[model samples]
Target: MISADTTPPLTAVDKGRVTLLYHFVRLQMPAVKVSEPTFLTHLDRTFRIFIPKAPGPVSWAAYLEGLYAVDWLVCVGCLTGQNGAWEVLFNARTGRSDCLLVDALRARAVRLYPRDEERQDTAVTEFWGNLIAPDSAGTLPVLARYDGQRPLAPWLIRVFQNWHLSKLRQSGGTTALPDDEIALPMDTPRADGADRWHETFIAAAREWLGSLTDDERLLLGLRWRYRLSQREAAKLFDLNEGTLTRRTDKLRDRALEHIGGKLVAEGWAGDDLEGFVLTELGSLLTDDPRLSADHLGRLLAARGKSLPAG
Candidate 1:
């Protein structure tokens, strides 16, 4: 449900944050850098994640592949290193107080104060005491707020960045994330990159899937809705495993082509559309309720199996 509202356009503060993040990552390595215009384009996609219906609680998607559509991937990577931080954030067997995510964030804090050991230690101390501390009810509010609608690693990275951003600002510092030589850039973001595009990605998905044939729809339903394996699904349709594989692959491509074309008609350019399909398309289709997988069971009465409860 990609709901719409009269929510005002991106504010100066939003642009400022994006500009800062864009410069933050580009300053690192060239190989990991995304162009400023491309970053701004994806920024719009990121803001849509928070469907802020006025005064109502923001409805967000489950966090299977959040970073899939997000910009500032390299910057995010810089904050959360590849240490299976995703698992540590919500692993049933792991503890939250001193997890891999915390360590990665601690490393980010270290980057903020590379030459100053005392400040680094103090920053890490404050982070643990404030964010990781359990409340009187014996629950960590920061970790508890995670609803699995977005990746915990990036969510925690934003939380960590905001913490430091506020701290530095409150301490009378002018920089967003202060370093000995680096600071977040201050510049306006270009909001017109994707002309006339107003988050119809989900709507397009619903229409595309709705147009599929019964058999075609059920093929997707078996995998996404019923959570059936390829062998099981193939057996259901009485097709060989190899033939089932090719058909599913074609369906995946067709979805991309259809969605990509819709966006292009809405003023998305070649590279911009490609950027989304390659990087962010996974987020929407991964666990979407309307478009891809969530409710297909209700539509599959022909299967004769008891439909799953809502």
Candidate 2:
């Protein structure tokens, strides 16, 4: 359950909020022709499809809204761009202090272009053969021509590092995605700006749902909440797809039993726990609005605290 003091939900992609994105992209990717509608679509797809599904109807709109409210919109833009190279560099800096960027670049370059002497590393093998082969659009050979011992240009890599670090220092926390995951299509068109705003809240809900202990809740988060492919979810949880299927089925049954038992214990014979959970999350956001944003930050921060060190 969330505390009562949280602020109302507001999103960056809300009706009039995307003028900033339009202005920013107008300057950064001048050749790419990013518009309000197109940026909104990208933001929506990112919020709706990018997060785990346990939290019900989580929305990035609120999170992004706060980000923009605090003038962290530039970091958000960097993450959502066509190539989030600087974003990836920013994320890599969190755990490292001394020479983090340089070390990460060296590690990334080594993994990207391994020597014949170090062929045993799987990350290296996969980087060239699997990762680049597909995303290159047949221009990988051209890229490799200049990348012998060094895959990326030294100066370009430095620029990416500098840009990412500057944003991190300015914002105080991270908001970017990795570089490899950004795959904006060349000819994407205009979208309804509202779509992005709606999805942000939904993503936040999914994040909350992921925190629950019930496997049914987890399954619900995975299938309907997060909209993740079962295979993808299985990989994330370190289980096989078949195992996930079985576990989810069992979870559904057990959840019903547990809910029914609790309802009976509470003097309500037929009350539904699943429905209660769903309705509670939905109503919490819709009724209060402010809870959506405040709860989301608390939920995310709490989860971050519980994660173990690698």
lDDT at residue 129 of model 1 (Cα atoms)? 57
**Worst 10-residue stretch by lDDT in candidate 1?**
180-189
Candidate 1: count of backbone clashes, pairs at least 3 residues apart or interchain: 5
Tell me how far candidate 1 lies from the true structure as C-alpha RMSD in angstroms: 16.9
lDDT for residue 156 in candidate 1, whole number 0-100 = 60
Candidate lDDT (C-alpha), each? 0.52, 0.40
Off by over 4 Å in 1: 1-99, 110-120, 132-144, 148-154, 165-241, 283-310
- RMSD after CA superposition, every candidate: 16.9, 19.1
Which lDDT tens digits does candidate 1 get at residues 88-168? 333312112334555556556766566778887787677555543553576544543333334445456556666676676
Which one is best on TM-score?
1
The ten-residue window of minimal lDDT in model 2 covers: 142-151
lDDT of 2 by residue, 1-310 (tens): 2222222344544545556545754665343444567565545443433233213444445434323221122223433353453344334332123344344444543433346335324433433242223434655321222211111233224333343345445878332332431111011232565344234434444454344564344345445423567786676556899999887777555544554444445454334545644443432233222322223333434444221122
Per-model TM-score, in order, reads: 0.41, 0.28
How many clashes in candidate 2?
Answer: 27
